[model samples]
Target: MRIADIYKGNTPVLSLEVFPPKPGYSLKSVFRTLDGLSDLNPSFVSVTYASQGESTDRTVEIASRVRDEYGCESLAHMTCISHSKEEVASVLDNLEDRGVGNILALRGDIPADFSDDKRDYHFASELIAEIAARNNFCVGAAAYPEGHIESKRISLDLDNLKRKVDAGAEFLITQLFFDNRIFYDFMERARYRKIDVPLVPGIMPILNYKQIKRILMMCEVSIPAKLLNMFDKFSHDPGDLAKAGVDYAIKQVSELVEEGVEGIHLYTMNRVPQVREIVFRSGLREKT
Candidate 1:
């Protein structure tokens, strides 16, 4: 199923996002992880492309396996860093032949070893345009609720999003955020700017203290003071922290659904147990 179509109908939909194994990791482990999570029967699963300087072929192979072996819809992440136009064309052809029909187009981060001039596509909008000219595939682009790291302001980020939509993005999935208000504000702003594509909210259920810090440092998102307090109180206590983290995520998801958001994408991090717990407590399965 095209995820956009899933959102258009009455069935409440949920999807999973998984990263391909890093280069040199055994494919056996990746398959084991997939087997653990497959019974959830997500609306779809997205396999992230490892960028330049990371394992590349394994990512593609995992995406193909998710669709063919698992019998689930899959979206392959396509990174434009360190890839020439010709290289991108070749990858697209390979994807077509493999029966993969969905992609998340991104202008990935520059490699530590490569100079700026070595990169072909600097902006994701450019990649969106190129993919729009191609054959049958659902093209997705990223949205930032707070703002992108590269953009100076939210207004500028919205303008960048408009360019991608104009280039024919089918739908949008936002960067993971904790606060529901931030995502609601982003949706209102997107409507104000006349960008009408179905916008899916990315939900990350915080599983631990270290992961929270990593998110604050790496992603352009803010942790609300309430959530910060949760971390501050339980950051040192492993058992208590896990309980509080799941509760917080459940509340966040319930409120978002009450507000009529399009859908939710869980960043599973290849951990089936944690993802299953979140879905069970969130009351989403019963409500739908």
Candidate 2:
């Protein structure tokens, strides 16, 4: 089913994001993660894309498996940064063959050695239009609540987002943000701009000191003082740190649900136990 349709029929749609294992790993571990999270009743599971050759294939395989193995909808992510228009068309055919109907179109990080002459797509808005032209898959795009790291300002990001929606994105899922206030502010600006698709908030649970540091570097998200203090006190204690991270997520999810969020998209990091705890403790499943 189209993810947009799912949103139409369901309230507070619960979703999870899991990536395909890197180049030389088995799918066994990811399946196990799904095994543990099955009972949370996710509206759909999004399989992240990798631009490399075989890794991209695994994205299709894993997304189809979600439906076949678990009887749930799947949202397959497709990155356009490294792909030709021809390559993307082939991917669309493959997705249809596998009965996967929803997609999250993205312009992944541009390669350091990227050459303009060979690029078929420069932005996600172009990719969204391509997928929308096919009219076979439901198209979704990403939003950065605090503005994208590459973007100079949030208003500029919002302008770009409006164009993507105009180009054919049916809905949007945001990058992970620790501060709900940031997301809340973004939502207000989005509505003011008249971009009226379902705006789902993406939440990433901070699991360890290393992970937190890496997220800061990669996403450029601002860390709230409460979280900074939590990390300061618990970074040395893995067990306590995990507990605190999960607790923080529970609070975030609970408050967003109370505020009538259209959905909660959890970046699972392929860790089921943490995600399961967050969903239950936050009362997401209970409300469903």
Candidate 3:
């Protein structure tokens, strides 16, 4: 199914994102994770891409399995960094052959040490336009509620987003943010700018302090003061920290639902228990 059609439904959409296992790790382990996630009956599951060699193939493999074996729609992430047009075409052709219908186009992060003078794609909008030319996939792109870390201004970020949408991104999924107000403000600005595709908010439960902190630093997302205090209070207790994190995510999801947000996409981080808890506790499963 086209992921864009999901937002057209009256009911709220719930989705999960899982990354492909890194090099030397067993793909079987991810299948076990998918088994648990599939039971939640998510609207779809997205498999994140890895720009490296074999890991890229694994992205297509996992996404195909999610759709074919798990009986759920699957969205595959495709990045255009350090890749030529031929390489991008090969990946897209493989996905199409596997019957995958959805793709999230990204201008991926370039490695600091790896510099390629000749790259076919520089921006995500260019990738989106290339994908649109095929007329084959439901394309999704990333959005920033707090503006992208590299973007100078939020308005300029939104302008870039408009270019992406105009290039044929059917929908957008946002970067993770702790504050819902930030997302709401972004939505208001997006509407004001007349970029009206379905914008799904991405939520990541704060599973571990170090992990989340590292992620926040990389993405430049601000941690809310209340959440910062909770993290400090639970710093010593792993069990308590996890429970508190799940509680915080549950609260966020509940409020988003009440506000009639179109969809909630959880970054599962390859762990099922916390995501399952948040989904049930937030009453998302009940509503669906």
TM-score of each: 0.93, 0.97, 0.97
Where model 3 places Cα greater than 4 Å from the true spot, the runs are: none
> What's the CA error at residue 71 for candidate 3, in Å?
0.7
Off by over 4 Å in 1: 112-114, 286-288
What total of clashing residue pairs does each candidate reach? 0, 0, 0
RMSD in angstroms, candidate 1? 2.0
Pairs of residues at least 3 apart in sequence or in different chains that clash in candidate 3: none
Cα-based lDDT at residue 186, candidate 1: 91
* Per-residue accuracy of model 3 over 59-142 as CA lDDT, tens digit each: 999999998899999999999986789999999999999999899999988767766678778889999999999999999999
Whole-model lDDT values for every prediction: 0.81, 0.91, 0.92
User: Of 1 and 3, which scores higher on lDDT?
Assistant: 3
C-alpha RMSD for every candidate: 2.0, 1.4, 1.4
- Positional deviation of residue 80's Cα in model 2 after best superposition, in angstroms: 0.5
- Tens-digit lDDT string for candidate 2 (203-283): 999887897788789889898999989988998999999999999999999999999999999999999888988998888
| Model 3 lowest lDDT segment of ten | 49-58
